[model samples]
Target chain A: MASKTALYDQHLAMGAKVVDFGGWDMPLNYGSQIEEHNKVRTSAGMFDVSHMTIVDVTGADAAEYLRYLLANDVARLEVKGKALYSGMLNEDGKVIDDLIVYRMTDPGVSGEWFRVVVNCATREKDLRWMAEQAARFDVALTEQPELSMVAIQGPEAIVKVKSVLNESRGRLIDSLSVFQGQESEGWFIAKTGYTGEDGLEIIVPEDEVADFWRALAEAGVAPCGLGARDTLRLEAGMNLYGADMDESVSPLVSAMGWTIAWEPESRKFCGRAALEAEKAAGVTQKLVGLVMDTRGVLRGQQKVIVEGVGEGEITSGTFSPTLNVSIALARVPAGTGDQAVVDLRGKQVPVAVVRPPFVRNGKKVFS
Target chain B: MSDIRNELKYVASHEWIRDEGDGTVTIGITDHAQELLGDVVFVELPEVGSDVATGDDAGVVESVKAASDVYVPVSGEIVEVNNQLEDSPELVNSDPYGDGWFFRIKLSDASELDDLLDAEAYGELCEDES
Candidate 1:
């Protein structure tokens, strides 16, 4: 039996096709996947992201503990309510998970409090890892499973959300800049999203999530599912934990070198040694974006050939409803060409390799 | 809104055959097969001159989500292939019973048509799967 979200029963009432996702009963889509995908690309859409595990690290040692635990430096966060995306690494330098750490300053959410939102699929592993690190630090680690998060995304996201919140609270969130979060009305509202769009992700108590979701939906925000969430993230060039890199891969070889902050010689972080070694030694493989010229859609684990160097495989691929083309993120040899071929069944289809994030800000960024 | 014309013989696998009254028999996948496959994105048919045995893998039908092998119902020589599907593969999703016909075979055994399921039997087979 899977744990149900606060909106689980409500999802069933809406005729949602519920599936077991990371031991949680969640909606894959309300009815049609293509329609849900299109809704996020064009207009405003809301997603029930309550399954994501948000852990709080607090006390005087929060910053030092995070520096030891994550590959990225949290000291970069100076202003209150600023969020930084980082890759949590294991001792071997393999990516444990990629998540966002929101620096809270309102005393209620931060000061001593630092929030990290991890993927649901990696929730258990992430929790365990955080505990093992906390046992070594003077910090108290607590998992707040009582909160529910709703990601309202697209060009009209802010407008749709602001229309529903309390007048004074709405002003606070509306005044928030992108990549910034603030505590208001006992909830943390962050202007962030996985989709390549302007949006706000609101964290509220579980009791209020269903009503909030309904309110957003009634306000003309489309109800999107995990399917669209995935395509949107892939289109943004953000690598998923299990699909892109996991226990065996390094940040240097993976598409996460930028997440590794090399500045400030005094700051020591986990995986820094292995990352520096990999960067100096040269990485064997890299994750690249590929757009299929052929008609068929590219899929995960499909074989990719880089000519003389050898073959690689696609990490994630799908037909972009926004781009109207088959786009994918592939893990190929670092020396792979501007042009490569994907083995679709028996036939080899040519694909153009370019920088990741085929689409950005709900528009095509690559040819 | 569905028509099960008596002139065409149906197979339990959802394949339909139109007996030309000549030696050659034209065949195509049924409407139910196209519906099960959400959207047809690509198709690969057997060579026109190749001899195919009944129940052998003759071609490939790829939908947006998955890929399935297209099996030949009756053994014969491949005569004509649907070239238009190569340009606009979604034709299989539109006119599956007509323009989406996969391939036509010059019959090696016309008696094989009698072995196929009729309209009533094919309709029942669809219900069973549901």
Candidate 2:
């Protein structure tokens, strides 16, 4: 049996096709997956992302602990609501998970408070790792399973989400800058989303999530599912945790090098020495985006043949509903060039190797 | 319940066949199959002049989620393939029984039709799988 989120009933009520996603019975789609993907690109769409795990870290040594535990420096967060995307790596430089860490308290507050949201499938190991790391510091990790998250994304996402909030909450939402999240009236409204669109990932208590979902639906926000979320994130060039990288893949080759903060070399974060060694040894492969202008869809594990270089495998691939093209992210040899061929079921089809973010802000971005 | 046309014959593999009564049969995936494979993005059809035996791999259907192999139900030479799907594969989801038909086959043996299932038997198969 699979676990159910707080919005599971609401999902079934809305005619969602439920599937097992990382031990959670979640909605794959309400109707057409492509339509749901388009909803986020064109109008507004809401996703019940309650299956993601949220861990609140608070203590006197919170900042110092996170700075050492994560690859990115949290001390760079100048404001309370600012968010940072970082890769949590193991001692050997392998990426354990990618997450968003938010500064939950004012800069000068006595004790540091931060909120981190990790992937649902990696909940057990992530929590265990955080706990083990916190043992040396004064930080306390609290798992907030009682809260549920809903991401409303698109061009009119902010307007639709604001319409469901009170005056002060709406004002707080309006005041939020990109990649910022603020708490208001027992809710955490963040102007951050996985989709490359203006949106909010609002976290509300379990008791209030259904009503909130209903209100958003009444406001014409289409109820999207995991399928749309995956496609939207892929189009946005965001990497999925398990698909793009795992415990065995190094962050240096997973297009996550930017997430590492190497400045202030004195501050030793976890996996720093290993990453430094890997970087010094010369990175071999890098993650790149593949575009198929021909027929058929690009799928994971498909062999990408780079003409004089070497072969690579697709990490994640899907038909871009926004661009009407098949796009993929693959880890190819460092010498791979602009064009390659994919063995799409015994047929070697040519593909263009371009930077990711195939679509952004409802428009085709890559040249 | 998915649409199960009584006038058509079905295989356990979720394909529906229509005996055109002219030594040929029109074949397409059942509505249930289309519903399971949501949002078809690409459809690979068998060549118009190729001969295939029963249970041979005839084509492919790639959805947004995954790809599935389309198998032939009866041995025959491929007569016609739906070209419309190359541009608009969603037809498989929107009208699986009609415009979403995969191909037409010139039947080599009409006796193979007896092995196919009726609407009721096909419905039971779908029911048991679910």
Candidate 3:
């Protein structure tokens, strides 16, 4: 049997199409996926993201433990409520999972704390790995499964979210900078999102989530689902962990090289040695964006033949609702040219290679 | 709930056919099919002069979630196709019975139409799937 989220009844009442996602019965769409996608792009939309795992790390060695566990340097977070995006890697420099770590207390102090949010599908593995790493450090790890999360996103998201909150909480939300979060009245609100739009991701106690969701709905936020979330993230050029890369592929080739901190040369992170070796040897493949030039849809696992170079495959592909064009993220040879041929049903169709972030802030960012 | 016209003939695969009264038939996917597909982004129509057999794969409808094959209902040569779908495939979701029609076929055998199901039978089929 699939598990249901705290707002499952609300989804049913809103006429959502429920589907099984990573062992959780979740809403795939409310009515139209495209409409939901457009709603987030144009106005405001909300999603129930309670299935994500939220782990709180606190102790004297919290920062030190995270420094050794994640590929990025968590020491860069100087202020409380600051967040850092990092890739949790195995010994082989392959991404175990990508997550956001929020600093709950100041650095270099005993009793410091941090919060890590990871994907639900990799919950067990990530928790196990985190515990194994924390064993050596003086830290305590606690999984907060009693929390429910909601993401409100779009250009108008901030104002609309304020409309549903108390004056003090609304003022706190207004003061937050991008990639920042703060705890207020037992709730954690962050000005961060997967979609390339202004938004707030709020994590509240499970018992209080239903009322919060209803308030947002009453405030005129469209109820979005997993379908629109996927499209929005793809259009923003963000990677889906399993589909884009996994334990077999390293960050060097996964468009996640920026997440790796190579400075200081002495961080000694889990994947530091392997990534250093790969960087010295040079990488062969890289992830890039693709726009179909013809009237066809680009789908994942499709063969991408780079002229006079090696063939590659699409990591993620979809019809971008904002651009009204087919876009994809493909992993191809590093030396691949600006144009490649995609084998669509045995017919070779041309595609243009470009940088990612096809759409941002409800506008086309790519030419 | 979707609107089902009593005058049209339907197949188990969710396609509908209408007799044009001049030895020809207009074909389209039922409204229920479009609702199941979410939003129609692209539709690949068969050539106007191509001959099709009943139950053969004629074309495809690609939505944001997945792609579905539009199967032929009655055997015939395609006479006309809704070219507007190439630019605006949402027509299939907005007006599936009229402007969203896929193609017109000059029936190779008009008698084959009897093999299709009535609206009531098709409605029962949809209810079972749900």
Q: What is the lDDT of candidate 1?
A: 0.83
Model 2 chain A lowest lDDT segment of ten: A103-112
Check candidate 3 and list the clashing pairs: none
TM-scores for the candidates: 0.85, 0.98, 0.96
Put down candidate 2 lDDT per residue, A186-284, tens digits, no spaces.
899898999999999999999999999999999999999999999999999999998999998898899998899999989999999999999899999
Error at B125, model 3, angstroms:
5.0
DockQ-based ranking, best first? 2, 3, 1
Off by over 4 Å in 2: none
Docking class of 3: medium
lDDT of 2 by residue, B1-130 (tens): 7999999999998999999999999999999999999999999999999999999999899999899999999999999999999988999999999999999999999999999999999999999999
Off by over 4 Å in 3: B1-7, B119-130
Please write out the lDDT profile of model 3 over residues A202-226, one tens digit for every residue. Answer: 9999999999999989988999999
Better of 2 and 3 by DockQ: 2
What DockQ, on C-alphas, does every prediction get?
0.29, 0.89, 0.70
lDDT tens digits, residues B15-118, model 1?
A: 78887777777777777777666556678888999999889888778664567678888889999888888877777777877888888899898888889888
